[model samples]
Target: MRTAAVIGTGLIGTSVALALTRRGVTVYLDDADTTAAATAEAMGAGSMAAPESPVELAVLAVPPAHIGSVLARVQGRGLAHAYTDVASVKARPHHEIQSAGADPAGYIGGHPLAGGERSGPLAASADLFEGRLWVLTPSAHTERLVLNRALELVSLCSGVPVIMDTVAHDRAVALTSHAPHLIATIMAARLENAADESVRVSGQGLRDVIRIAAGDPSLWRDILDANADAVADVLDTYAADLGGAVTALRALGSADETRRKQAGADLDDLLRRGNRGMHAWCGNRARRPPVFCRCP
Candidate 1:
């Protein structure tokens, strides 16, 4: 696309604008908070002023809750030829937009599976989406032009495009992103009441597990709200696993020899399963011959 408008000047929006601008696309910037628009403009993302004419595409980078209404309003104003949103939740917003009487032909739903523990235009980077999966969800009513525009946007941002049904996309993120986010939060929340001595001995392991817990709670709440059912389903399974671990731990205190042996086996099984899962995620390189540490 030759030109585009980014309708929210937050981290994702600014990052997308920066990427498109770097690719020589004329980007128009706007946000409900004018300062955010100005901030993005100052960062060389795009012009803060209104575009003279409708751009080739418009990206609604608002929160999941606002996407439907924001899209409806922008399209109502003839803002662009085609539109897409970067909201993490897809199915709900897609259906909501349709329910709001917005034209689905001109819109496509998208989510870039990349970000940091930061928000706003200042935290945005042109490379935020590099090598990351960006999901596209187009329904039967979606127009080819809208889908193509979104694909171009993803390509310009150096993102890998994966097309999925809206519902599948929601479920996928619940397993891979949403559920994990809440897990991290729960782990991190433990630190809130932790004694200073305990927290003082923090290690990389804790940091790694709780990294995403630093994300804005308000934003995460909206995301969780949108995909509550899927997230709850994931959490239910996780709780079962946690209960198994607890049972194994309590069994470690059993007076019976058989019970103690069974507990050891259970713990070993869980650890081995975790190792296998990690190896699966790490792919072929994990199976390669390992080089031992050579430090003398």
Candidate 2:
């Protein structure tokens, strides 16, 4: 596409605009938050207003909750010839467009699986989506032109496009993204009452585990609510594993050598399986953890 409009100049939106602008595409920016959009423009990301006429594509990079309504209004107004969104969840918005009687032919559902524990235009980077997965969910009524435009946008943003049905995309993200964020929040919440000694002894392991807890709670709440059923399924499975861990830990406190050994072995097996699973997911073998030693 020669020109594109990014409708939410927050982090993802600004990053997308930056990527598009860098690649010589004329980008027009629009957001309810004028300051955010202007800031993105001043940073050379794109223009601070939508073009007078319909652009090649309009990317609605708003939160999942705002996507459907925003897209409906924009598309209704003929803001762009084709449209897509960068919301985390897809199914809800896809249904929303159909229910609202918006032209599904002009739009596709998109989600770039890349973000940081940060927010706003200032946090945006042109390379935010680099080497990351971008999912496109095109319904039966979706036009090929719109789907191609979405894929082109993903390519310009340095993302790898993976096309899947809306339902599959939502469920996959619930397991790999949403559920993990919930776990991180839970882990970090426990640290609120941690003793001074406990906090003082914090290591990289704790830091890695709770990194996502730094994300905006309000955003996460909306995302979790949107895909509650899928997220709940993941949480239920995690709860079962947690229960097993608790039972094993209690058994370790007993005097019985058999129980203690069994618990230790069980924990070891779990960790090994986790390592293998992660390695397989990344298509790589496990590497040794970095060792730090002080000279005496």
Candidate 3:
């Protein structure tokens, strides 16, 4: 595209602007905090304000909570010919736009499954979305041209494109991302006031499990709330597995040696199943590392 506008000068927004600018697409930037937008512009991301005329595309890089309203305002003001968002949750904004009687025809929903543990424009990287999955959810009313444009944007960012309905996208993210984030938070919460001795004993296993716990809680809370039912389903399944583990461990202390041995065997089988399942998920054969590069 010739030109684009990026709303919200956060990490994702700034990164997108930088990528587009690098490709020789003129980009205009707008954010509530004008200084932040100016800072992004100074960093060579884009311009400090919206273009005078309608841009070819507009990327709304705002928080999930503000996407719908911001999109409506910008589209209504003729700020862009077509628009898309980078919100994590899609269904809520999709419904919000429809309910508000905004033109969903020129709009598409997009989510890039790429980010760092940090936030804000300073953390932005032009290559943030490279090799990552970018999901697009288009309604029946969505224009073909708009869909193609969105796909082109994903390709320009070097992202893999996946199409799904809004509900399906929400559910998939709830299972794969939201639930895991919450589980990590729950694990880390136990160590909040941990003594020096206890924290000093922490190793890679615990660190790995709780790494995502460093994510912004407010952002995650909004995401979890948007897809509560799906996240709840994942949590329910996890709770069932945890219950089984507890029962098996308690059974290990039983008076009967045979019963205890059976319990131990059951636990061993469960652990083996977990290992096998993880390997399958990682596409590992015989627990070997995934082949990242192939010889010519």
Candidate 1 lDDT tens digits, 239-280 = 998999999999999999999999999999999888776665
In terms of lDDT, model 2 sits at: 0.89
User: lDDT tens string, model 3, 88-191?
Assistant: 89999898887776799999999998874577788888899987889999999899988988988888788889898999998888877999899999989999
Using alpha carbons, what is the TM-score of model 3?
0.93
Clashing pairs in 1: none
What 10-residue stretch in candidate 3 is worst by lDDT? 287-296
Model 2 C-alpha RMSD vs. true structure (Å) is 4.0
What residue runs in model 1 are displaced by over 4 Å at the alpha carbon? 284-296
Which structure is stronger by lDDT: 1 or 3?
A: 1
Q: What is each predicted model's overall lDDT from 0 to 1?
A: 0.91, 0.89, 0.86
Per-residue error (Å), model 1, residue 268: 1.2
Cand. 2 TM to true fold: 0.93
Kindly indicate the candidate among 2 and 3 with the higher lDDT.
Answer: 2
lDDT of 3 at 237: 92
Candidate 1, lDDT over the whole model: 0.91
Count of backbone collisions in candidate 2: 0
Which segments of model 3 are wrong by more than 4 Å?
Answer: 284-296
lDDT of 1 at 43: 99
